[model samples]
Target: MPNLPKKVRSKKLSSRVDLTAMVSVSFLLIIFFMVVGELSKGKAMALSLPEKYENGWHHWGCGSGSNERTITVLLDENNKIITYTGFLFNPRKAPKEINYGQNGIRKELFNQKKAILEYSTALGKPKNGPIVIIKPSKKSNFKNLVDILDEMAIINIETYAIVNEFTTEESQLLASK
Candidate 1:
Protein backbone atom coordinates (compact mmCIF):
# COMPACT_ATOMS: atom_id res chain seq x y z
CA MET A 1 0.00 0.00 0.00
CA PRO A 2 1.04 3.64 -0.52
CA ASN A 3 2.23 5.79 2.45
CA LEU A 4 -0.82 5.51 4.67
CA PRO A 5 -0.62 6.66 8.34
CA LYS A 6 -0.48 3.74 10.80
CA LYS A 7 -2.57 5.81 13.24
CA VAL A 8 -5.39 6.19 10.68
CA ARG A 9 -5.31 2.45 9.97
CA SER A 10 -5.67 1.76 13.75
CA LYS A 11 -8.90 3.81 14.13
CA LYS A 12 -11.40 2.20 16.56
CA LEU A 13 -14.78 0.93 15.38
CA SER A 14 -18.09 1.86 17.14
CA SER A 15 -21.73 0.86 16.89
CA ARG A 16 -24.87 3.11 17.25
CA VAL A 17 -28.08 2.08 19.11
CA ASP A 18 -31.60 3.41 18.53
CA LEU A 19 -32.86 4.96 21.89
CA THR A 20 -36.48 5.33 20.71
CA ALA A 21 -37.54 1.83 21.86
CA MET A 22 -35.77 2.23 25.20
CA VAL A 23 -37.41 5.61 25.81
CA SER A 24 -40.84 4.18 25.00
CA VAL A 25 -40.34 1.27 27.44
CA SER A 26 -39.19 3.63 30.19
CA PHE A 27 -42.24 5.85 29.71
CA LEU A 28 -44.61 2.91 29.89
CA LEU A 29 -43.01 1.66 33.10
CA ILE A 30 -43.28 5.09 34.68
CA ILE A 31 -47.00 5.29 33.83
CA PHE A 32 -47.67 1.82 35.22
CA PHE A 33 -45.94 2.62 38.54
CA MET A 34 -47.81 5.91 38.86
CA VAL A 35 -51.19 4.24 38.36
CA VAL A 36 -50.35 1.42 40.75
CA GLY A 37 -49.25 3.91 43.40
CA GLU A 38 -52.51 5.81 43.18
CA LEU A 39 -54.67 2.68 43.33
CA SER A 40 -52.74 1.38 46.33
CA LYS A 41 -53.56 4.54 48.24
CA GLY A 42 -57.32 3.79 48.18
CA LYS A 43 -59.12 2.45 51.24
CA ALA A 44 -58.05 -1.12 51.80
CA MET A 45 -60.85 -1.96 54.24
CA ALA A 46 -64.47 -0.74 54.49
CA LEU A 47 -66.97 -1.59 57.24
CA SER A 48 -69.92 -0.24 59.25
CA LEU A 49 -70.13 -1.40 62.85
CA PRO A 50 -73.38 -2.47 64.53
CA GLU A 51 -74.63 -1.35 67.91
CA LYS A 52 -74.80 -3.71 70.86
CA TYR A 53 -78.14 -5.05 72.12
CA GLU A 54 -78.46 -5.59 75.83
CA ASN A 55 -81.42 -7.94 75.40
CA GLY A 56 -79.51 -9.86 72.74
CA TRP A 57 -82.18 -9.15 70.10
CA HIS A 58 -83.37 -5.80 68.84
CA HIS A 59 -85.70 -4.93 66.01
CA TRP A 60 -84.75 -2.63 63.17
CA GLY A 61 -88.01 -0.74 62.44
CA CYS A 62 -87.29 -0.05 58.80
CA GLY A 63 -88.91 -2.97 56.90
CA SER A 64 -85.36 -4.13 56.07
CA GLY A 65 -85.84 -7.43 58.00
CA SER A 66 -83.43 -10.07 56.75
CA ASN A 67 -82.68 -7.90 53.77
CA GLU A 68 -81.57 -5.04 55.98
CA ARG A 69 -78.09 -3.67 55.53
CA THR A 70 -75.76 -5.19 58.16
CA ILE A 71 -72.50 -4.05 59.64
CA THR A 72 -70.28 -6.06 62.02
CA VAL A 73 -67.74 -4.33 64.27
CA LEU A 74 -65.11 -6.48 65.90
CA LEU A 75 -63.55 -5.48 69.23
CA ASP A 76 -60.23 -7.06 69.93
CA GLU A 77 -58.76 -7.88 73.36
CA ASN A 78 -58.03 -4.21 73.86
CA ASN A 79 -61.69 -3.39 73.19
CA LYS A 80 -60.72 -1.66 69.96
CA ILE A 81 -62.17 -2.57 66.59
CA ILE A 82 -59.58 -4.46 64.62
CA THR A 83 -61.70 -4.38 61.47
CA TYR A 84 -65.28 -4.30 60.26
CA THR A 85 -67.58 -5.99 57.75
CA GLY A 86 -70.25 -3.82 56.19
CA PHE A 87 -73.23 -4.07 53.80
CA LEU A 88 -74.04 -7.46 55.23
CA PHE A 89 -77.22 -7.87 57.24
CA ASN A 90 -77.74 -10.81 59.58
CA PRO A 91 -74.20 -11.80 60.25
CA ARG A 92 -73.44 -15.33 61.43
CA LYS A 93 -75.15 -16.11 64.79
CA ALA A 94 -73.93 -14.02 67.69
CA PRO A 95 -71.49 -15.11 70.36
CA LYS A 96 -72.18 -15.24 74.13
CA GLU A 97 -70.86 -11.76 74.92
CA ILE A 98 -68.97 -8.87 73.34
CA ASN A 99 -66.49 -6.30 74.66
CA TYR A 100 -66.22 -2.68 73.54
CA GLY A 101 -63.47 -0.12 73.95
CA GLN A 102 -63.28 3.65 73.42
CA ASN A 103 -59.98 4.52 71.72
CA GLY A 104 -60.83 3.64 68.16
CA ILE A 105 -64.60 3.66 68.59
CA ARG A 106 -65.09 7.09 67.07
CA LYS A 107 -62.88 6.24 64.14
CA GLU A 108 -64.80 3.02 63.64
CA LEU A 109 -68.14 4.80 63.73
CA PHE A 110 -66.93 7.38 61.23
CA ASN A 111 -65.65 4.59 59.05
CA GLN A 112 -69.09 3.02 59.10
CA LYS A 113 -70.72 6.26 58.02
CA LYS A 114 -68.21 6.71 55.27
CA ALA A 115 -68.87 3.21 54.02
CA ILE A 116 -72.62 3.72 54.19
CA LEU A 117 -72.38 7.00 52.34
CA GLU A 118 -70.26 5.47 49.64
CA TYR A 119 -72.57 2.51 49.34
CA SER A 120 -75.61 4.74 49.20
CA THR A 121 -74.04 6.96 46.59
CA ALA A 122 -73.13 3.95 44.53
CA LEU A 123 -76.73 2.74 44.72
CA GLY A 124 -78.05 6.23 43.93
CA LYS A 125 -79.75 6.43 47.30
CA PRO A 126 -79.22 8.17 50.64
CA LYS A 127 -77.14 6.99 53.64
CA ASN A 128 -80.25 6.28 55.69
CA GLY A 129 -81.01 2.99 53.94
CA PRO A 130 -78.43 1.01 55.85
CA ILE A 131 -78.83 -0.06 59.50
CA VAL A 132 -75.81 -0.19 61.73
CA ILE A 133 -75.32 -3.03 64.20
CA ILE A 134 -72.64 -3.31 66.89
CA LYS A 135 -71.16 -6.37 68.58
CA PRO A 136 -68.56 -5.92 71.30
CA SER A 137 -66.59 -8.65 72.98
CA LYS A 138 -67.73 -9.67 76.46
CA LYS A 139 -64.55 -8.40 78.03
CA SER A 140 -64.88 -4.93 76.57
CA ASN A 141 -64.88 -1.96 78.95
CA PHE A 142 -68.27 -0.51 79.86
CA LYS A 143 -67.15 3.08 79.31
CA ASN A 144 -65.93 2.38 75.80
CA LEU A 145 -69.08 0.45 74.99
CA VAL A 146 -71.26 3.32 76.12
CA ASP A 147 -69.11 5.76 74.22
CA ILE A 148 -69.70 3.86 70.98
CA LEU A 149 -73.43 3.98 71.60
CA ASP A 150 -73.25 7.68 72.27
CA GLU A 151 -71.39 8.24 69.05
CA MET A 152 -74.08 6.34 67.16
CA ALA A 153 -76.70 8.48 68.79
CA ILE A 154 -74.84 11.59 67.68
CA ILE A 155 -74.89 10.32 64.10
CA ASN A 156 -78.58 9.46 64.46
CA ILE A 157 -78.19 5.84 63.44
CA GLU A 158 -81.16 4.90 65.61
CA THR A 159 -81.99 1.64 63.94
CA TYR A 160 -79.42 -0.73 65.35
CA ALA A 161 -79.04 -3.94 67.36
CA ILE A 162 -76.62 -5.28 69.95
CA VAL A 163 -76.02 -8.99 69.46
CA ASN A 164 -73.76 -11.48 71.12
CA GLU A 165 -72.41 -14.18 68.87
CA PHE A 166 -73.68 -17.05 71.00
CA THR A 167 -77.11 -15.50 71.65
CA THR A 168 -78.08 -15.25 68.01
CA GLU A 169 -79.63 -18.71 68.01
CA GLU A 170 -81.86 -17.93 70.95
CA SER A 171 -82.89 -14.57 69.52
CA GLN A 172 -83.86 -16.15 66.22
CA LEU A 173 -85.90 -18.75 68.03
CA LEU A 174 -87.70 -16.08 70.04
CA ALA A 175 -88.47 -14.11 66.90
CA SER A 176 -89.97 -17.20 65.24
CA LYS A 177 -92.47 -17.46 68.09
Candidate 2:
Protein backbone atom coordinates (compact mmCIF):
# COMPACT_ATOMS: atom_id res chain seq x y z
CA MET A 1 0.00 0.00 0.00
CA PRO A 2 2.95 2.30 -0.78
CA ASN A 3 4.00 2.44 2.90
CA LEU A 4 0.47 3.74 3.73
CA PRO A 5 1.17 7.38 2.69
CA LYS A 6 -2.29 8.93 2.76
CA LYS A 7 -4.17 12.00 4.17
CA VAL A 8 -1.07 13.83 5.50
CA ARG A 9 -1.51 17.66 5.87
CA SER A 10 1.02 20.50 6.77
CA LYS A 11 0.39 23.19 9.41
CA LYS A 12 0.10 26.84 8.25
CA LEU A 13 1.77 29.80 10.07
CA SER A 14 0.43 33.44 10.43
CA SER A 15 2.56 36.48 9.16
CA ARG A 16 1.42 39.44 11.31
CA VAL A 17 3.55 41.97 13.32
CA ASP A 18 2.84 44.68 15.99
CA LEU A 19 4.54 48.01 15.09
CA THR A 20 3.04 50.14 17.89
CA ALA A 21 6.18 50.03 20.06
CA MET A 22 8.48 50.91 17.16
CA VAL A 23 6.37 53.89 16.09
CA SER A 24 6.21 55.15 19.68
CA VAL A 25 9.98 54.93 20.08
CA SER A 26 10.53 56.77 16.80
CA PHE A 27 8.23 59.65 17.86
CA LEU A 28 9.95 59.92 21.25
CA LEU A 29 13.37 60.10 19.61
CA ILE A 30 12.18 62.81 17.21
CA ILE A 31 10.85 64.91 20.10
CA PHE A 32 14.07 64.51 22.08
CA PHE A 33 16.24 65.64 19.13
CA MET A 34 14.00 68.65 18.51
CA VAL A 35 14.18 69.78 22.12
CA VAL A 36 17.95 69.41 22.21
CA GLY A 37 18.32 71.45 19.03
CA GLU A 38 16.15 74.23 20.41
CA LEU A 39 18.16 74.32 23.63
CA SER A 40 21.46 74.55 21.73
CA LYS A 41 20.36 77.52 19.63
CA GLY A 42 22.06 80.80 20.68
CA LYS A 43 21.12 84.42 20.22
CA ALA A 44 24.11 86.70 20.67
CA MET A 45 25.59 89.70 18.90
CA ALA A 46 29.29 90.00 18.04
CA LEU A 47 31.06 92.99 19.59
CA SER A 48 34.70 93.95 19.17
CA LEU A 49 35.86 95.13 22.56
CA PRO A 50 38.91 97.37 22.86
CA GLU A 51 42.08 95.90 24.35
CA LYS A 52 43.33 97.08 27.73
CA TYR A 53 46.75 98.58 28.32
CA GLU A 54 48.61 99.38 31.52
CA ASN A 55 48.80 103.13 30.82
CA GLY A 56 45.13 103.98 30.71
CA TRP A 57 42.83 102.98 27.82
CA HIS A 58 44.63 102.93 24.50
CA HIS A 59 41.98 103.45 21.85
CA TRP A 60 40.75 105.91 19.28
CA GLY A 61 40.32 109.56 20.36
CA CYS A 62 43.19 109.14 22.81
CA GLY A 63 45.02 112.21 21.51
CA SER A 64 43.90 115.75 22.16
CA GLY A 65 43.37 116.55 18.48
CA SER A 66 40.91 113.69 17.97
CA ASN A 67 38.76 114.60 20.93
CA GLU A 68 36.61 116.95 18.88
CA ARG A 69 36.01 114.27 16.27
CA THR A 70 34.12 111.84 18.50
CA ILE A 71 30.41 111.14 18.25
CA THR A 72 28.66 109.24 21.02
CA VAL A 73 25.36 107.43 20.56
CA LEU A 74 23.34 106.40 23.63
CA LEU A 75 20.64 103.77 23.21
CA ASP A 76 18.05 104.03 25.99
CA GLU A 77 14.83 102.17 26.49
CA ASN A 78 11.80 102.76 24.24
CA ASN A 79 13.91 103.08 21.07
CA LYS A 80 15.32 106.43 22.08
CA ILE A 81 18.66 107.50 20.61
CA ILE A 82 20.67 110.39 22.04
CA THR A 83 23.64 111.68 20.11
CA TYR A 84 26.38 114.13 21.00
CA THR A 85 29.90 115.18 20.00
CA GLY A 86 33.06 115.53 22.11
CA PHE A 87 33.37 114.69 25.80
CA LEU A 88 30.39 113.81 27.97
CA PHE A 89 31.40 116.43 30.57
CA ASN A 90 31.70 119.10 27.87
CA PRO A 91 29.58 118.10 24.95
CA ARG A 92 29.80 120.19 21.79
CA LYS A 93 26.06 120.68 22.02
CA ALA A 94 23.12 119.36 23.96
CA PRO A 95 22.50 115.71 23.29
CA LYS A 96 19.85 115.54 20.62
CA GLU A 97 17.18 112.88 20.31
CA ILE A 98 16.91 111.23 16.93
CA ASN A 99 14.95 108.38 15.38
CA TYR A 100 16.07 105.52 13.18
CA GLY A 101 15.38 105.98 9.47
CA GLN A 102 16.42 107.81 6.33
CA ASN A 103 15.61 111.16 7.97
CA GLY A 104 16.84 110.23 11.39
CA ILE A 105 20.15 108.86 12.62
CA ARG A 106 21.37 108.29 9.08
CA LYS A 107 20.97 111.94 8.21
CA GLU A 108 22.54 113.03 11.49
CA LEU A 109 25.53 110.78 10.93
CA PHE A 110 26.01 112.07 7.40
CA ASN A 111 25.85 115.69 8.52
CA GLN A 112 28.19 115.16 11.47
CA LYS A 113 30.59 113.17 9.30
CA LYS A 114 30.65 115.95 6.72
CA ALA A 115 31.33 118.53 9.38
CA ILE A 116 34.16 116.48 10.86
CA LEU A 117 35.69 115.93 7.43
CA GLU A 118 35.54 119.62 6.72
CA TYR A 119 37.11 120.45 10.08
CA SER A 120 39.94 118.00 9.53
CA THR A 121 40.68 119.48 6.15
CA ALA A 122 40.51 122.97 7.51
CA LEU A 123 43.10 122.05 10.15
CA GLY A 124 45.46 120.82 7.38
CA LYS A 125 44.99 117.22 8.54
CA PRO A 126 43.92 114.24 6.50
CA LYS A 127 40.16 113.98 6.00
CA ASN A 128 38.81 111.44 8.50
CA GLY A 129 35.27 110.66 9.52
CA PRO A 130 34.04 110.94 13.09
CA ILE A 131 34.76 108.13 15.58
CA VAL A 132 31.40 106.79 16.68
CA ILE A 133 30.97 105.37 20.20
CA ILE A 134 27.84 103.31 20.67
CA LYS A 135 26.70 103.00 24.31
CA PRO A 136 23.75 100.75 24.98
CA SER A 137 22.09 101.08 28.36
CA LYS A 138 21.02 98.03 30.32
CA LYS A 139 17.41 98.76 29.53
CA SER A 140 18.10 98.90 25.82
CA ASN A 141 17.31 95.90 23.67
CA PHE A 142 19.38 94.13 21.05
CA LYS A 143 17.37 95.32 18.08
CA ASN A 144 18.32 98.97 18.61
CA LEU A 145 21.99 98.10 18.85
CA VAL A 146 21.79 96.16 15.58
CA ASP A 147 19.98 99.02 13.86
CA ILE A 148 22.69 101.49 14.83
CA LEU A 149 25.37 99.11 13.59
CA ASP A 150 23.57 98.79 10.27
CA GLU A 151 23.47 102.57 10.03
CA MET A 152 27.21 102.64 10.55
CA ALA A 153 27.76 100.36 7.54
CA ILE A 154 25.21 102.12 5.35
CA ILE A 155 26.82 105.51 6.07
CA ASN A 156 30.29 104.15 5.31
CA ILE A 157 31.64 104.98 8.72
CA GLU A 158 35.30 103.98 8.96
CA THR A 159 35.78 104.00 12.75
CA TYR A 160 33.43 103.08 15.61
CA ALA A 161 33.33 101.44 19.03
CA ILE A 162 30.81 99.64 21.20
CA VAL A 163 31.45 100.85 24.73
CA ASN A 164 29.66 99.04 27.53
CA GLU A 165 30.07 101.44 30.44
CA PHE A 166 28.69 104.94 30.78
CA THR A 167 30.24 107.93 32.51
CA THR A 168 28.39 109.68 35.31
CA GLU A 169 27.80 112.69 33.08
CA GLU A 170 26.41 110.49 30.35
CA SER A 171 23.99 108.91 32.79
CA GLN A 172 22.85 112.35 33.89
CA LEU A 173 22.44 113.45 30.31
CA LEU A 174 20.31 110.43 29.57
CA ALA A 175 18.24 111.08 32.66
CA SER A 176 17.69 114.71 31.77
CA LYS A 177 16.48 113.75 28.33
TM-score of each: 0.40, 0.65
* Clash list (residue pairs), candidate 2: none
Q: Given candidate 2, what's the lDDT at residue 74? A: 95
User: Per-residue lDDT for 91-140 in model 1, tens only?
Assistant: 43232233343435555556556766676667667645446555566665
What is candidate 1's local distance difference test score?
A: 0.52
Cα lDDT of model 2 by residue, 1-177, tens digit = 568768868776667788999999999999999999999999786554444554322336366546678888999999999998876556775689999899999999999888888888888876566888899999899999999999999999978988877777778878988
Candidate 2's error at 174, in angstroms? 1.5
When summed lDDT is taken over every stretch of 10 residues in candidate 2, the lowest stretch is 50-59
